[model samples]
Target: MSTGDGVDEVAEFAALLTELKERTDRSYGSLARRLGMNTSTLHRYCAGEAVPQDFAPVERLAEFSGATPEERLELHRRWLRAVAVRQAARPRTATTTEPEAAVAEAVLPEAAVARTAEPEAPPAEAGRADAAEAAGADSGGEVGSGGGPARRWYRRRRTALLAAVTCALLATLGTLSALPADRSPSASSPWPSSSADTSGSAPARTTAPAAPRPSPTASPNRSSSPSPTPGGDSPTPRTPEPSTSGGTAPGDATVPLTWTADSQAWALGCGHDYVVAQPPARVPPPPAAQDAGPWAAAQGAVHGRETVVEITVQGRSTTAVVLTALRVRVTGRTDPAPGNVYAMDQGCGGSISPRHFAVDLDRDRPIARPVAGNDTGTPIPAVRMPYRVSSTDPEVLLVTARTQGCDCSWYLELDWSSEGRTGTVRVDDHGRPFRTRSIAGLPRYMYDTSARRWTPYQ
Candidate 1:
């Protein structure tokens, strides 16, 4: 069947599968080994020459290849369409037994009347009739005399019965053809719905149970807590957590800790600064704190001086995940981006007390050190690692990575343990490393809100 795009459903599904496989950068043999399937079988599925009886294998392959949630849902829909097409193309056979029985029932009464009319016959005639019956049985024909009025009547009746049966079969076929083609799965279908758990290891079943609905009262992954201001006794502004859902399950090989990183979170003081390749005249006015990421991208900007990233981590299945440590891996170091310095704001004076860590990117081997908030009057104590996070209780970490000597491209590695399993999850700006360029000697500028124009920083 077509998938509304003129391409066959099976071919579309195969194309998506092949794309995911290629994105992983893993060889077919290695991926097959991890999936516990033959290499040739996977090749056939990706080649559009075959489809799997179960979707579990496909799901596992998708997860291993790092498909997003939306992609996975679309893949499931395509699989359903392909399965429907295959089922419809199968040949169907009709049985003739029921129609033949109906014909027999209709002819029984007439045959009895004919027999009554024909009373006792001569011995020779009876013997001849018996021989005719034997010959008819051997040839699988009607049970009647060889050539007489009765035999002719029987032939006419048989012809009418055959004609009636043929008409009925035609009518049935027409009715079937008039009905709409339904691609949806039937009540008895073995495949699961799109909402089924996508943990990459769900077993195939005849019927999928309803997925558990998320609770209305469930707390968000990022929650705000009160922290002290830089100087005054008043409470500080609540640092908003990154908006994200619960963690995803990474199969049985590692801990089921789900996390997300937001690099655009409030960077207090000069933390929101960025170095754009454009000049002051070409740059747009500074945007709100939340719009910093996109604004910087539009101006072709890179993080300046330091980049403060907010990471929210949660556990799946109500199990607690212990965050052991945060490690920094610097991929490259070079001279800072050559451009004008732009500050997101004149100044953001607030102390952040969320599990804060600091990384000096200029060091050969940078380490994440737990650092206190930037409060001068009273230093907020630093929260240490090994924090427990569950579905009901999630934790947020604010990592401030700074560089003074070089422009650094780096990413974070989070080591976690839960339920006797331990593994590491890499955190970066999507698939690329987070970049922070040193702004040691550049002039800082900010948009003057009162004047509605860009001005040099005081």
Candidate 2:
């Protein structure tokens, strides 16, 4: 659009045409049909038999073919250059002896100057122009043009290992020139792409940008509407995509909402803030992270000291054993579950003892069948393991585990859903393990327990 751009859209248009033919394997007739134009028109353009008067169709077609805004602009500039050359080419004009030839010599590089010099242009120019216009088009790229953007990005991400290995080493090796947004010498005729990409490869043109055009086959109103390309007119995002392994907010319907018990919900990062799906959606009070004793535990039966557990074997064959203990009882009760009653203190509670427990399934199977360990009342932290059985309603239960490194209490809230049931365990809650992290292997794990040993289930 600027005067300094030199050539006009014609040259850029030519580049777009060439790029299209190369990028797609479609035959000429097929391409014409897609453009809603007659094959002969396409042939004339391809064969240099005729020049387009409107230029809209050619530009639009380029857009539909996924050409970028920069490319489109270059095509426009090249077109202008081509027209100026033609005017200069008028035979024996009063002042100009050969305008077209002169303009051609000025715009075209030394290599191509003599080759394309003529009163009439050739088809190959258009083809080459189209491809050249999109020098850095790639399907998955988010940036393009000069290397400024990429270089700045490298500076910011210098600490990132991937950035260092991908940019630093590549540049020192002289392979960086070919990396991201680099402009080729031949691309001077058109405005060079912006300097945003840094992948050390020309940023691939993303999806075609929006344009102002109407297709012959479509209604006038609809066809004439503008189309914008993906990342064409907008700035690229600075941050990397967040890790998929993290937890999602409650509103994500895709995620099974596992509501924590109001009393134990605080341990789930509820605090004073309403985080849990108390009313389901809208905004509910966050579950309380217990600050005092049993009443303020991370995750366990509200009043009782046991809970349910649904276990899914990871890499090895293992079973989830629900060990119950009565924490309120004076002494601890270490008893295995019959169906689902769990406890931490068998002798400590009213009629039971304060306790801790652990369990594992038969060693033969790597992953045990989906089983539900129902209410082994009050699954206390440091006393048992936590595992999930199903992901359907987003259930949560407390299970205990004995790790190789140490014995700690933590909670597990089913981040994802599968054929297995969901569960939550208390980590470092109350008299449990001293450390305070749960969702360990899950990365988002929050550890909340202290020094407490969970014996492996026999």
Regions of candidate 2 where Cα sits further than 4 Å from its true position = 1-16, 87-192, 197-458
**CA lDDT of every candidate:** 0.64, 0.32
Estimate the TM-score of every prediction.
Answer: 0.45, 0.23
Give the alpha carbon lDDT tens digit for every residue of 246-285 in model 2. Answer: 1121112222222222223221122111111112122211
- Residue 185 of candidate 2: its Cα lDDT? 18
Give the total clashing residue pairs for model 2.
Answer: 153
Best by TM-score: 1
Model 2 lDDT at residue 85: 47
Q: How many pairs of residues collide in each model?
A: 1, 153
- How do the residues 160-252 of candidate 1 rate in per-residue lDDT, one tens digit apiece? 766885676466445434432112333542334456653675332111113234345532222221111122222332221221112222121
Error of 2 at 66 (Å): 0.7
Q: What is the lDDT of residue 283 in candidate 2?
A: 22
Determine which window of 10 residues in candidate 1 has minimal summed lDDT. 221-230
